[model samples]
Target: MKRHASFLGLCCLLIVAALLGGCASLPAPRPVPPTYAIQDVASTRLARIAKQNALPGAAELSGFRLLPEAPFSFNARIALASRAEKSIDAQYYELRNDGVGRQLLRELRDASLRGVRVRLLVDDLYMSDADELFSSLAAYPNVEVRLFNPLPARSGSLLSRIVFSIHEFGRINHRMHNKLFIVDNSFSVSGGRNIADEYFMQDGQANFIDMDVLASGPVVREQSAAFDIYWNSEQVRPIGQVASFDLSPEQAQRRFDQWVGGAGHGLPENERDALGRTSVAHQLDDGKLDQFHAKAQVLVDDPAKIMRGRMEERFQGSVSQRTLAVLETARSHLFITSPYYVPGQVGLAQIQRQLQGGVKIIVVTNSLAATDEPLVYAGYARYRKEILKLGVVIYELSPMLSQRSGRLGEFGKTTGRLHGKTAVIDDKRVFVGSMNLDGRSASLNTEIGLVIDSPEIAADINRIISIDRYTSAYLVRIGATGGVEWVEQDSSGTTTAVHEDEPETSWFIKSKNWLLSPFVAEELL
Candidate 1:
């Protein structure tokens, strides 16, 4: 009888255990999405107010206040040693894609660990991957990470997107489109490069055409200040504060190592590596920037409260300030290089007006072959002919630029992609930063750039753009005879051209463009 009782008890326990297991719910898995891939105008009324009441170094750089290249003191520092001096360097490090991007990220991570204040402001679109190796860096107490206009997407379907507003939808199409990294208010790296494998050329050695400017002068301070505004803004969230993510350094380190070791972790390994190298040991000591020349003014378009008699809302003032300055100041020539080009009717009209003013405007953006975001290209196509009619020249990059440059030597194929947003006016001034020449850039996203007034610097930027224009870019030409052609140079140092009117685009592309055009889903691109 005792043996019988024991067996019955055991069976009842097993049944209860099974029932409990059935009732328990498993945790949901994190979502991962596929990799994918701004503007201005205005008048001069505010210019006088800004000029009269601007920051210390604002005026000289804003409007043709030419500073002769004589010995002027600029702040500089070396890695954790020395005194402050001017940074006279005209040529800064140009890091594109993965090769240098990984190094940069590593450097950022190290800088934070050593008690050096670090700030990372990325356009929210680039931070979709929850699996990125940020926790290790985020583990550092002084480090902060914020996403611009980050709205998490829940589903990839179009219906899901439409049903989901920018407020609730999983896909946030209108994003914060600026990329900035400021360390210790002394050194910075800004440009088209995002913290990704492709931008750093670490993604299969695919050379993503990108640009970065490493600045150390007073400009660094200016850049950092703008970064601080975005850092403290509502759009950003500290990495540590992100819910559902609570990991200590030891745990994060293990995860990072697994990621770096190819344990099937999804992040681009080199970006993590870059984060590792930005140690506090690399902090610039003062006296290092003595060589940098020219003063700089930081132009930022942050959303700020605008009150109009009992109404208050955020305005993209930075966009208005910077773009209006550039458009109004453009004299003989205008050079624009943006990866994404979407000019709606108003935007197109603005360019036309600029053209009517007799400015030679040349624009270089991504082609269907080179662009990662096809939907953006669909929107761009709507304005291509109209833009050409208004005397604006357009060029699209080839996907080959997406392949790593110089990694495989001269014999390897070169894909010339344009991943930089810059503007040069009459070889007198240059603007470089995260903003693009698009509607979203003008009204939706927060953007930042440097308005540099050094003739030598402008010349260098102009040369770079011109080289890319004639060599790496395709020329969309409409002659006086009304002939439209997509002209390109041959690989063998020859010239060959194709006309868009000739049905040159493959049927596949035509169908894809057709399908994506109607959606007007400007947010995703």
Candidate 2:
């Protein structure tokens, strides 16, 4: 009977493979109607407000504001969309159909209703069972939805999709991980965030401590250029080209209304007002936008990076590669905040050189217990001792942090994880964006970031985070036996408890790590 069952299973698998191979082939890339960002916005409200408050003689430069709060960051995008006069170009790696995601779509719908052109480009890797919503969104008069790196098998299990599209594995594996939002080609926002409940601190199960920058002025033009590249890339496809939609325009409006318009999880008038960027809009209205004035340079991975061969990828002007080049110029101190920091041999060599040159390096990352990607921690653990021996300071966020609802937000039953990616150099420059120090960010995925030359902004960011002294993170150190130890500190920055193992890490997970760490490669994590 066991033999019969095995044979039957094999037969079923073969049958499914044959069926999928026959029907799941992706359609050939169709000609995408080219669209470019509108650049004649010098007279627009955002452009005028941004210029009014630009750095004294640096009015021609860009301006930026750090958004560390979840509620404010979420609302800032909404506010910009609400105030959008001409066009809104929003791009992200992932945009779920959850509560907050739906609300954001609703805002876009409203913006379109007011005659604003809307273009939403989202990655298709995790977009399963969302054809109806996106197709419906595209049905609106002024809205267009496109997918980045879309898959052939749209409606099936993730495993089935991968299996059916195995022939194109190399292409499908590469993804566009850039995130940006622009209004009227003037005001923009970018960082390591996607449209989801967890990112906004609304997910009671768990949440990430993240950061975003609200950018305006000259640098926004560069950002819009990056968006235009991906929007018109061959990897992107109009929603109608990938999936079939039966919803009429009227039906589309009804569908959107049902999803976000007055229901459970719907924002009440008062709450919506609180969530909206009325204050930001008011500041713009008054031409008194509070932001740091800085000369900023934008870096974006060329959209064609994913389509190139291995050797060609290394020279694709990738954001991670360029960011590393900037880090090499660090004179005194380098403060890095990345959650999944699996610095491979190349990165370690860079760190060694920096330390030998008398540069101080500090890293803030997630502990095994607090991280959403537990397996990724295994890659970091392999280099923890070596990193500590090189005189680098390390801090791992503690799980105890979730007990209270503070700046990191209420993780509730789960732990707060670090998701922000930024680095400060000599307290005079700041690099903020979606690029992580991990292997995947280096080559597998595309990313974007900003390099700002402004001591005031760097100092302010450092004072609030990274090296604030008072933090809910454990000081990682090498023990006398050369093993790792996590020193838990008090509010006054005194060591109150010492953990011989990864604090709050379960024994089962430890065993799993022991088995899996050896097989894990630094670059892949």
Candidate 3:
């Protein structure tokens, strides 16, 4: 009886110790500045940038040019950074420290060295080892770096961060999904592509078929305004404050030079020349670059979106709201391209309403085989039949399609995945930005995009969509018996029907998706 009692006591002691250790492993919330200080910074920065860059009736003078190709898009950003005489502000959802990221960092560093003030804001959820590099970059005199919604403990490993996220899922899951690059308060690029190798086709294994719009005039100022809001928000912490690494300016510069100089060593000479020749700076200096003019408006979610427990009433003028307003104005047709599409009941109802009004809707999204996020695909898969029944034409991109349509250099024997998020409404307006047509984009994460009143741009995007439907995507339709079928065209102009969710998807992948779909919460995807 005494031995039994001692065993029970020992078990209780172990349980208590385990509980204490678990609590200790959890991340402690970092301290932030006082509310007054945060408010002061926000107000001051907003007012100052508005006064300096805002023009009277500036909307009438806005202009936009589509950077449809990845190489051209990459070059445009580097050129803007190289030519920026006054300031450069950039914000992104992810900034991997790969070859493409290093090259852009080098450009920003060179710009700073030439007396341009540079501010970079990046989301911290996927920052990984880039924290130290950002810390080093911030050591430059004319440059500053801030991370949005950073993890509490910078020393924590990825597994610890995941555990912390499970504990604080509500706050940590909501991210800033905005991508903007503004230079000199005059030019900007806002779209789906983040700063990484895969985005620029530098990743040999996989490359994203993405899009960006190069804008000047009024819209650029609007993007800068959005950047200022995020930059000054309380959630944004300086890299120097969060990262433990301490390196002097000279050391940082040397490290940056070494990284940048070593990039593109293995690339073929032709590809290297292609990257070098498409420089916007060279074209602008030679007076050969063409600029298109149109009325443009920048739409972005409120920075307060990152705050937890906010009422839905607070999201009155959100990016999604603005997009829906534009959609309401659609009279003839709507074309949407989203990589991960899971339109819930609200979206379904909206499309049904549009269909009832005789408005044609066409959607292009990634297939199960082409998607990088199989869980997101699972969420989207359940809605396919319902959407097809509602008379919405759907196109699923195939992985076998090469990225050869948009004047982007041919990636030899590469698999294509849809990553561009865009919409063309009635061939009158075009939207290109970082907002995905998923539940997370709708009510969870913050997003940003540009609405350009340019029929030419809308028509161009529509043409691309039509071409992709025939060449690189499968048309999903309901059969006579209420089943769904995928129709694709062959190289010899022959059409075939594929009676599967994704014809090219592996059996194991299909099985995994089938097993996981029943367990996933669609709204969180």
Candidate 4:
């Protein structure tokens, strides 16, 4: 009987392996219909403001507003959506099916209902829970939903699909990390935040300190063109083509109503009123910006980057490469904030060259206690000492022993992990977008951001994040005996106590990470 059971288990294992291996597949590519962004918006409210107040071709980089506060940043999207006249094109790495996410969807549906065209492109990694919602949303007239680099097997859960379809690992491993949102091709917002409660600071469990740049003028048009490229790429599949539209138009309408109506986590009426009063639409209606104006250019990775073998030689013009090229021009202080930081050997070499050149560089990243990915923390830990010894200033976010005020103030009350991917050079140029200072963002995932040549923008970003770095993070440094130490800071931004170990992390976790970090690949983080 024991032999029989062992033989049965072996057969089961063989069958599972066969099923997994069989999932390795993609048929001939389905031809994507070409669609370009609507560039003629001479009469729209946004165009009136953008064109009137836009910096001339002299500056090159144009209208921009930094969004650091979560509530205000999120409100900006709704404001744009509410006022979109002709079209709204938005894409993101993730969109949770939570309250705020559903609210955003409802806004899109409402815009579509008003004869405004709506297009949403999302990465397929997190769509297992939201695929049915996408199917329903796609049913609305004038609303289109698509997935970029969709996983072939969608019937099972995301994990099961990955387990069964291990054959498509090459394509499945790469993803679209880019986030771009445009209204009427006149105004746009591009940055690290996805359409989720945590991104917007509504997540009760935890949140991210994120950044985005809302812009107008020439930059918006360039952003629209980038969106067109992804929308027309063969790798992007319409929601209907990828998932069954089980909900009919009538059924979808009722469901959409339910989804939107059930979302009770929207901003309070008073906060909404405050945001509306200060909206760009409100300020721009008079044809000028109460915000900073600067020269800027949009950078985006090609969608085809994810459609091919990741090991293939990379091409130029990638967002990261372009941003780094801009960084190469840095002449003074360099400030970098990447929540999931694992600077591999190549990145470290580059940093060393800059440090050797006397660049005052400051890096702010998540500590082991605050990081969302402990395995990623393991990867980051592999080079933590090497990085510290290179004379670079490093600040790892500490959620437990931090004081708060302004945007950084919320970290003390709620769990806050740094999610802003930003770098400022000499306080003259700022790179804000979705690119992290890590191998995954550098090569595997597609990214987008603006390289702004504006001191005003850079200064504002530096000011807000500097506040967080001083108050909410541990200053990692080489101790007297060559060991690492975490220096805590007071609310007054003065260094106080020193801890010999990772302040909030347990010994078991630290030991496990120390032991397992050797196998954690930086490129996969």
The candidate that achieves the highest lDDT relative to the unseen native structure:
2
Candidate 3: worst 10 consecutive residues by lDDT? 1-10
TM-score per prediction, in order, is: 0.67, 0.91, 0.85, 0.91
Q: Let me know the TM-score candidate 4 reaches against the reference structure.
A: 0.91
**Residue-level lDDT tens digits of model 1 in 1-525:** 010111112222433444432121213323322110000101222222222333455433322121110000011111221211211111111222233333444545445555444445444333324424554545555545444544344223322222232333222333455555443334445565555444433354233555445454456556655655655665555444442356766787666544444222122222111112222222222111212245666777653421111111223355634565575588788888787788665567678777888889888888776665555667787788878887887877755432322221121343434567777778877777777766546654556677776666676566545654555556776755677666666434356655554122467876866874675444333
**Residue 410 in candidate 1, Cα distance off native in Å:** 7.9
Tens-digit lDDT string for candidate 3 (1-525): 000112112222433434433422223335544211111222332224323333456546665667666777888787677666777888988887888888888888888888878888998777756677787777777888888887654545544453443445456567888999887776678899998878877778777888888776657667777788888887788777667555677887777677677655222223322223344545555644445567878888988876746535434667876787788788889999999888887688898899999999989998887788777888888888998988999988877654544223355566678889999998989899998887767767789998888898887776556665666788888877777787786544367646645777898988877886676565467
lDDT of 4: 0.77
Per-residue error (Å), model 3, residue 9:
38
- What shift in Å separates residue 298 of candidate 2 from its native position after superposition? 0.6
**Candidate 2: C-alpha lDDT:** 0.78
**Candidate 4: which stretches are off by over 4 Å?**
1-29, 56-61, 264-288, 308-312, 315-317, 402-413, 491-493
Q: lDDT of each model, Cα atoms only?
A: 0.48, 0.78, 0.71, 0.77
Q: 487 in model 1: Cα distance from truth in Å?
A: 1.3
Off by over 4 Å in 2: 1-23, 157-160, 263-279, 467-470
Give the worst 10-residue stretch by lDDT in candidate 4.
1-10
